[model samples]
Target: MSETGKDEKKTKKKGKGLLVKAIVGLGLVGSGGGAAFGMMQAGIIGGEHEKEDNEPKLVRKGEEDPYAPASKDKETEGLGEVHGEGGSEYRTSYYSFTEDFTSNLAHSDALIQVSLAASTRRDGRVLLWTKKHELAIRSAILGVLADTPEEDVYALAGKERLQKRLTVAINKVLTEREGFGGIDNVYFKSFIIQ
Candidate 1:
């Protein structure tokens, strides 16, 4: 073998060793950076915004609530509370039907108009259902009012009974539409017969 060939072989081996070391170093640096990013995302490192909790913790009486909306007053917090038959606490809420219904009375020349609102001690879902099914509820209410006799609107007892029937009709519509009837009552915001 010539001396030049051996010298070239040694030089090539040293160059290859340096190239391998450079590649391994770059790989180590890239993996280390990726691991640091993952650790920050998992909140084991320096990231401040990663949070596991979505809902605020329940605030007890007289204690301050940091996450409460600025417009909501603390004193009005439990106004819609209800106690169940088994003594569990629940919330009550109301939903007002925005449009009023007018219908001609059954078997008479009288015309009637009524503005209504419904309430439930269950949850906000009842209110949501009421809004979603308002058209059907309005139809059912008109039917009830049309079937009402002129005498019924004039008498207190009969008016109360009609209110109950209206409530039942509303609950029926809700049950059919949303598969739940949690409305406790239907209240007459305005009632007129002429």
Candidate 2:
């Protein structure tokens, strides 16, 4: 082959190799960028984005929960039973104590008969009035009664405290169960310790 022809062929091959390399590099860069962009859009890496600043933030972690705002405020106006000026109607019911206390007493290994009245909210949510648990409540009352050593059943100074503890215990049980809303308060209809 002639020298000029051989030189021309060598230059053409080099140009083709460089073009292929450039195309492959571009494809690799584009694929990486696209994957990163997709991940960002899917929110896999970014922190929680804040809502609009003007909206009222509802604190959902406490006992005094703010009511969820109505979708349309005008539609809810003058709708249901009004108690005072702006008070809404509150529905409440009593769930009687029908379960056998023998089994519970055996399980708890405590000597106490506690009858409670559960006050339910309108939305069926139950909130215990205090933080005291049921077993602790029964034990406290039993302790008090044991110390007195006078009457099997009587109104004591710690009656209110006992009631609050019982309420908390009932609420703890209810809240632990599935589909349990909450317990409002617990009223002692009767109490007997022997």
Candidate 3:
């Protein structure tokens, strides 16, 4: 073949090869993008549609809670306390730990003991979870107490901060276990430092 013709043919083949490669690359990219979009729509990738099952919800004073723990005594079935209209619209429930938490103070020989109760405005599932996970909650509480400074336990402001920390600790445990933390406040039912 003539030199110019041979060179032209080779250039044409190279051009065709480049075009095919470009098309194949574009096709692969399009397929990947489509798959990712499908996964997101199906909730397999992004968590936009993901939701907790039967998450605890706030209970109004007169509203019923389907998730509330059933009363063991038939006599108490209709004996629930009536809430007044003056306070919060939501009903508050309390869960008291059965045992006291005793731990040595941080960086001191002094010891502290406390009996605590947690409150929640949500349904009774929170209380039930608290009772069920009391062991883990107690451990978290003791860790906080052991880390608390001795002087902090004596001051009112420091005590308030400690309460907040304890509340966070309890909620962290509950969230890790049950995917939700409903504790509103942590009350010091009894506090003693020795």
lDDT tens digits by residue: candidate 3, 1-194: 99999999999999999999999988998998799889888888975975647789999988988767677453222123335677898988777777899999999999999988888889888888888788899999999999999999999999999999999999999999999999988989899999
Model 1 root-mean-square deviation: 9.8
Tens-digit lDDT track of model 2 for 101-175: 321232333455556555554331222211223344344434443433223234565666555655565655554
| Model 1 C-alpha lDDT per residue in residues 43-136, reported as the tens digit of each score | 8888796765432233333344343323434433322323334431433355667778899988999999888877675544565567667789
Worst 10-residue lDDT window for candidate 2 reads 123-132
Error of 3 at 143 (Å): 0.2
Where is model 3 more than 4 Å wrong at Cα? 1-53, 72-85
Per-model TM-score versus the true fold? 0.55, 0.36, 0.69
On the 0 to 100 scale, the lDDT of residue 119 in model 1 is: 68
The number of clashing residue pairs in model 2 is 3
RMSD of each: 9.8, 11.4, 6.6
* Clash pairs for candidate 2: 126-182, 126-183, 127-183
Highest TM-score against the true fold, candidate: 3
